[model samples]
Each structure stands twice: as structure tokens, then as C-alpha cells.
Target: MFDSRHIQTFAEVVRTGSYAATARDLGYTQPAISQQMKALERAAGTPLFVRAGRGLRLTDAGQVLARHATGILSTIATAHGQLKAITRLESGRVRVCAFPAANATLLPATVARVAAAHPGTRVELLEEEPPDSLRALREGRCDLALAFSTGHGGEATDADGDSDSDSEGGLIELPLLDDPLMVLLPAGHALAGSSRVELGELERERWIAGCRHCRGHFVAACAEAGFAPDIAFATDENLAVQELVAAGAGIALVPGMTLPLLRHTGLVARPLAPAVGRRVSAFVLEGHETAPVTALLLRTLSEAAADMERAASGSPRPEA
Candidate 1:
């Protein structure tokens, strides 16, 4: 029945040898400190201190409480250290899910960074699209999900709203970055020569759309055209989309992250006019134990993103 606050106050007063000093050090008023001490003593059903000159010294009962409290403090400190090691990466498994675009830029770099820093740690990567990534995190399928969107970036939410969907309740969403959406078109395409193109310009062009469930490609890029894309094709294969563009079959709206990974030399990359960007974020369940690893991954990806941004500005990305 010993409260942590009471024990902490008792220890502080004992260490400082005066309630006034304890109050000063802890930012508590003297009266409040005294009240807590009295409550602690009452809870223990014993006297815990005795007046010694202008200070109070431990009574026999107080000594017992101090001894127990010291152990409690030590236990708490050890637990904290354990969690720190997990963050600093002493050892553990980190499971993450990412959309294709994020995996292209963010995830690989993150994995490499985590691997080098925490060699004892293991990472499992699951590739899922935007909203589905959120679902995976809520269902406990993974520790973290790299969720994404057209503009607001990705956020992890507890999907536990109704005992029905993939998203579970008690979830935590963490924002990562807002990635600029770029144009992927065949080389020498009129739109590619320009630095950027607005979504509206392509309203009449044949569009390569993502599958129905993975609406990111269509919604983020083509939706701004103010008309649904004339879906000449629907496929998750970004490579295929680029190939089709190169073949003059159609053009596609591709994430800027994919520019560095595209190997099709016949294709050209351009930024979206008016500078549209998608938001990317990581999702985790509430009270997750792998917070350290997830944090490391998120941090590394951010660093990589900054580096990419530096290269992307005023410079065309070399074809992969």
C-alpha cells in the first residue's frame, strides 16, 4: 500500500535532512511536502521521522521505510535502463510495414541504418499500401506501419473503433514526412520537358491507376485533375507503369521517392506543378515495447529524406 509519491518524498526528505529543503528541490511548497509525508506515515500506520535540531532525522520506523524505498528506486532505475537499451538498441526485433513508394526511399535506408547500429536487433519488413498499412499496425500484425497519404503524410491510429476492421483501438500514429509527388512520363513527352506539371493538365491523358484498394496513386495525383483518370490500366507494378509510359501507352503519377529507383532510361521524371506532395508517417500500437527500434527507423528515414531533398533540388535524378 506504499505509494510511490510518498516513498519518493520520504526518501527526498531523508536525503536532504529537512522538509523545507526537500520542498525547495522538488518544487513543492513546504506544506504540501509535509502533507505527503504525513499521508505516507498514515498509510504505513507508523511514525516515520523525529525532530533533530532544525532538521528531521529518521525514526526507527522511518529507517525501514527508507530502506524499502531505496530498493524501489533502484528497481525503477533498472527498468528505465532496460528500456533505454532497447531504444539505444541493445537487442530486439523491429517489425514494420511500408507502402511501395516509402520502401523505395525511406525503408531501405532505415533498414541499413538500423542494421549497422543495432547488429543484435532484427527487422522484418512488410510491404502494404497506405490505408492497409494502418490496418496491419492496429491488428498487431507488426510493431510499426509506415502509413502514407497524398498530402497529410502518414499517421498511425488505433483502429480499435469497431471490433470489425483491420485497424484496432489503442493505436498510436506518428508522422514521418511529406514527399513531393512527381510526374513519370516517357522521355521527350511534352510534359516531361517542363520542370513541373499540374494534375489538371493531364485530365485528358490516359492514366495508369493503382488497384481499387490502393487508391493513393489515383487520389493523390489524378484526383486534382478534377476528373477521374481514364484508366487505361490498373496495376500495382510501378515498373510496369513506367514501362508503359516509355512505350507511349500512357503516363503515370509517381511518387518522387520512386524517381531514384526507376531503371527505365526511356522515361523522364518531372515534379508535379504547384508542388504537390504526399505525407508519409509511421504507425504503432499504443504501449508498444519496440518503441526504440521504431524511433530509430523513423529518424533514419527522415535523415535520408533530407538528403534526397538536397539532391532533388535544381538537379535531375539519374535514372536507376
Candidate 2:
């Protein structure tokens, strides 16, 4: 078998194009570098280098081996990095999936905290809705999932009827916060000055709906109010919904987690009467919940959520 050390040395030699330079760079004696090259060539069953004037050149076999060796060494370095991260808890990669709103508002500060505290750790964010985030967590495609429930009885379920249990095979859910859905209205609309609005009041108003589950919540709420909404536009994007409301196209129901991302100036938000909302939670594989990196990230997320809550309540931000 070809030793990884020899393959690394060979790649370094190709990079430097001089045995002495490779030896200096790798902290190996010139003779040791030569010996490693010979060993690599023998393992390849062909000569890998030749004399060209006062310098050395790669033979056809050497060129082929060098190409493969570069990739092999790079993979080895990556493996080493990952192993170091796992063993030390000072560095690692955490894959996170969240809906677009949370990705915009909640994830940024949490990820920034993680990056600052553990500079070696890498956090990757993926935008996905609740069902998809949970699926990604269960399939081992993601280490963390920031998912939400519409709180309108439309939560995703398996055969067991457990909304947040391991029926999906060892998945764990950590409830983070309840993000209440608030109605968005144009600033000049009839009910814009109210602190809260009844669904019945907006029955005839043009409406902007969200995803299928969100629309389901709106429809159910409207039905409870004895009317069906005249949904004029359907979009899941928080900004788009806000813009539509700002432009007087229609009103919408937006989740509290998306509050910080609202940039439209001509819109007003009011809570629903009787309190309709969504529950945002973090999901992970059962065994990974206690992992140091995952735990740290979870704490940061909770802190960020708290900050968002304070901001939403018009409270002054706490000093750092």
C-alpha cells in the first residue's frame, strides 16, 4: 500500500518543483524526501521523476500519480481537520435548516455568536419549511433543524399522532418559542390603528396568503369568523407578503419571528384576537442533542430568540 506520507511528499515535490525546496517546506532531509519519492514510485510500479538539465521533471506516470496524490492529500487534510474538530469541540461543522424568516432574523445572530465564540466551527444555514427541515434532520442530511408549527392543528404528523416525538425514528424536538401570527395591514387601512383585529373584521378585505399550511390556518381562522377570505395573492416569502401589504395590494398574516425583517414603511401589524400563532422549535437526531457544538448552538439560538422577543415587545435591548 502507498503510504499517505509518501504521497503527500510527492505532491509537495510537484508543487515546489525542487526536491530541496520540498524537503525544506516539509521539514524533511533531502535524502528522506528522495527515499519517500522512491517508495511512492515503487508503489506505483513505475518511475515517477526524471532529470531535466539541473531540475527534475515528472514522467507520464509521475504526472498521473501527482494528480491523484493532490486529491488524496487534500482529502486527508480535511479528514484531519474534522477529526480535530470532533475531538476538541473547538471546531466542527453544524448544518442547520430553517424557514426563510428564521433564516433572516434568528439565525444570523446565533451563527455570529457561534462563529465568534468558536471561530473554528462552521455553521451552514439551509432555507427549508418545517416538514422539509424535519425530514432533513431524520435523514442525517442536517445536524440541526429550526422548524415551526402553524398552531392551527395542521402540524405534520406520522401514524402515532405525536406532533413532536421520535415516531420519525429517534428525532428530538426542542421547543424554542411561540411565534404568533399577526395581521399586516396598509398604514391607511380601516383597522390599522387597532392593537388587535378580529378575523371577522377583515372577511371582505383582499388577503395575501402564505404557504399551504399557512393558508390553511388563514382559511380555518376565517371560517371560524363565518367567512372565507378573498385571497388575492399567494406567496411564502415574508418580504413579498410585507411588500404586498405595504403597496395596498392586500393584507397578510405574518409570524412573529419575521417581525425583525419587515422593512416596508407603509404597513402596520396587529395581533389576532384569541391569539393565533406558530411554535418554532429546534430538531436534531436524538443522540446529537447533547453534543457540545450542538448544545452551544442551541443556547445561542435561544438567546437570539429571547432578544427578538424583547425587541418585539418594544423593550430596550439588554447590554451585552
Q: How close is candidate 2 to the true structure, as a TM-score?
A: 0.68
Please report the candidate that would top TM-score against the real structure: 2
TM-score of each: 0.61, 0.68
What's the TM for model 1? 0.61
Candidate 1 residues lying further than 4 Å off, grouped into runs, are 1-91, 151-168, 213-223, 314-320
Clash statistics: count for each candidate: 13, 0
**Residue-by-residue lDDT tens digits, candidate 1, 1-320:** 88887888889998999999999999999999999999998998989998999999888988887888988976666456435434533356766778777777777777887788878768887888756776555445566777654432222222322232233354555555566767788888877788778888887888777645344545644555577777787778887887888898888767776778889899888877678765666655556534676667667766776667667665655554
In model 2, the runs with Cα more than 4 Å from the true position are 1-91, 156-164, 316-320
Q: Over the full model, what C-alpha lDDT does candidate 1 score relative to the true structure?
A: 0.70
Where does candidate 2 clash, by residue pair?
Answer: none
Question: In candidate 2, where is summed lDDT lowest over 10 consecutive residues?
Answer: 156-165
Alpha carbon deviation, residue 316, candidate 1 (Å): 15
